[model samples]
Target: MAETIEEIASRVRELRELSKVTAEEMAEYLKVPLETYCCYEEGKTDIPASKLFEIGQRLDVDMNLLLTGEEARMRIFTVTRKGEGVEVERRRQYRYQNLAGKFLSKKAEFFTVTIDPMKEKPTAYSHPGQEFDYVLEGSLKFYIHDHEIILDEGDSILFDSSYRHAMEAKNGRPAKMLVVVI
Candidate 1:
């Protein structure tokens, strides 16, 4: 089942409180404006997965805990069968499936992200680390900092994620991509 933004926001708030971290502190940690972070905590704005992952790191919790309200327990390899990964519905135009949600102490987070065609521009986000994306189906226009690159099926890119980046489908069709965040 797809978790609602409100449910995720509530969990974020709960986790923050349980960690004894204040909203102001979280905003500082995330390097975002207090009001913007407040909007995320209040469910007024959708929290990007990258930002949520950062929050999980800052709070010392598994990212799955924020996405699925479940902690990863498997310390070794975990096998996720087809269509069995955890689905995260953070935006109307995108679907994120956590492929390694059951793995513990993961060095990199893996997800299969599907971007639906939209007339409205997608928002760019950046955090400290590296990101890799491989086009699995359809075409995608990747916006990294000031450069724009187009990728078709079987194409891939890996780069520093500290620079603002975002991707959207091309030709008004949905694009499926495998995303790995480190």
Candidate 2:
């Protein structure tokens, strides 16, 4: 069964309690206001994918634990069948399939991202890592820092993800790509 946002929120609250960490501490660490963090933990708001990843790292757990309620322990190899990845709807126009969510102690996070064309200005998101994107279908206009670049199928890019970045589907069509964040 697919876990709902409420379920994930409950796990977040439960895990933090078990770890003896206060919500305020988590909010401070995430650099968000206490109210905003509380909303996410209470299921009043959908938690962003980056924020969820940060939470998992801080709790010393794999992203699988946060998404599926199962601990990932495989150190040898893990295979995710096509269309079998954990799905996350992080934002309105973005759908993410976690390609390696069940791999434990991962040095990088893999995802297949499907993005719809924007209706307004795309929101910029940034994290403290590097990112790689390979377009698999359609076209994407990627904005990094202050520049915009158009990428088509089979095109790939590697960039410092610490700077603000965003993407929008081009030609009035959706874009799909493989994303690796490290």
Candidate 3:
């Protein structure tokens, strides 16, 4: 079974408490509303992978701890078998499978993202650093700021993640892509 959002949220709350960090402090650090952080702890809302990574950094824990409830001790190399990667549910239409969740002190976060088609427009999000996305299957409608780009399988793009960006599935089907954030 894929990892549920509730389980991840619970781990977030637990780690925050163990670290003795207040919700207000986390909210301030994330630059999000206090209620938003509270919702994340309460499992009332799905937490973005980027936000979870930020939490891991701020809480001085590895992202694997938050995603798998297990610490990554290997600094050399780690391999996640096919169909065994940690699944992260960031939104109803977005499913992310962490490709390097077991490697310690990762300088970059990698994921295989599966995006389902939506009737409504997707919300764009921004974070510090840069992002590279390569379409693996199907097609995607990608938006960066006010520019829109259509990417088919085998196409790739790299951009500053600070700009608001979002992606939607094309042809009313699910799309898959490889995403690396650094």
Candidate 4:
């Protein structure tokens, strides 16, 4: 079914709550006031398309998935051409609300994320879970528990998510990483 703006807003709110991010925190992340962010969630204020996309990225969900309940699933295949290659195909599922709710429902949760280099620093995702992040591509710097770690491709780290954490590309290049919560 085609989704409406209201549905998208509601889902955004759901995901935000599931992420255990308070409205005040979100407001700070968005560089807006708490009441303004609250209005955006309540649908009292219309979110610009650009800002909407930003929010989706921050939440690590496809903009479409947030607009619609349907998830984005794809089969990605990779092949190397140097004769020392293997064909690798994997199914990836991007479920915005579903995954958010799953993590929120659990005492501990995990996430896999990709950040666009053009965007601002990602808002911190916090909860009672322990989180591990492994950099897959590009460079990223993580701010966790008031400490900063610059991660290059293939670098990995683990920490408690209950403490504040945020991430940004260190070299102005897009970053890809896997986050596991437990």
Top model number, lDDT: 1
lDDT of 1 by residue, 13-125 (tens): 99999999999999999999999999999999999898998999999998889988988999868999989898887677779999998999999999999999989888888
Model 2 compared with the native: what TM-score? Answer: 0.95
- Worst lDDT window (10 residues) for model 1? 85-94
Q: Which stretches of candidate 4 lie over 4 Å from their true place?
A: 1-6, 11-37, 43-110, 118-125
lDDT agreement of model 4 with the native = 0.59
Estimated TM-score per prediction? 0.95, 0.95, 0.95, 0.48
Better of 3 and 4 by TM-score: 3
Query: Going through the candidates in order, what is the number of backbone clashes in each?
Result: 0, 0, 0, 2
Candidate 2 lDDT by residue in tens digits, 11-128? 9999989988899999988778999999999999988888888888788777788888888877888899998998888888889998987778899889999999987878888776
Task: Point out where model 3 deviates above 4 Å.
Answer: none
State residue 122's C-alpha deviation in candidate 1, in Å: 2.0
lDDT of 4 by residue, 26-144 (tens): 77876668888888889777554334545765777765456555454533422223222111111121111122321112333233465566444555545544667788788987888
Local distance difference test values of all predictions, in order: 0.92, 0.89, 0.90, 0.59
Best prediction by TM-score: 1
Deviating ranges (above 4 Å) for candidate 1: none
Clashing pairs for predicted structure model 3, backbone only? none
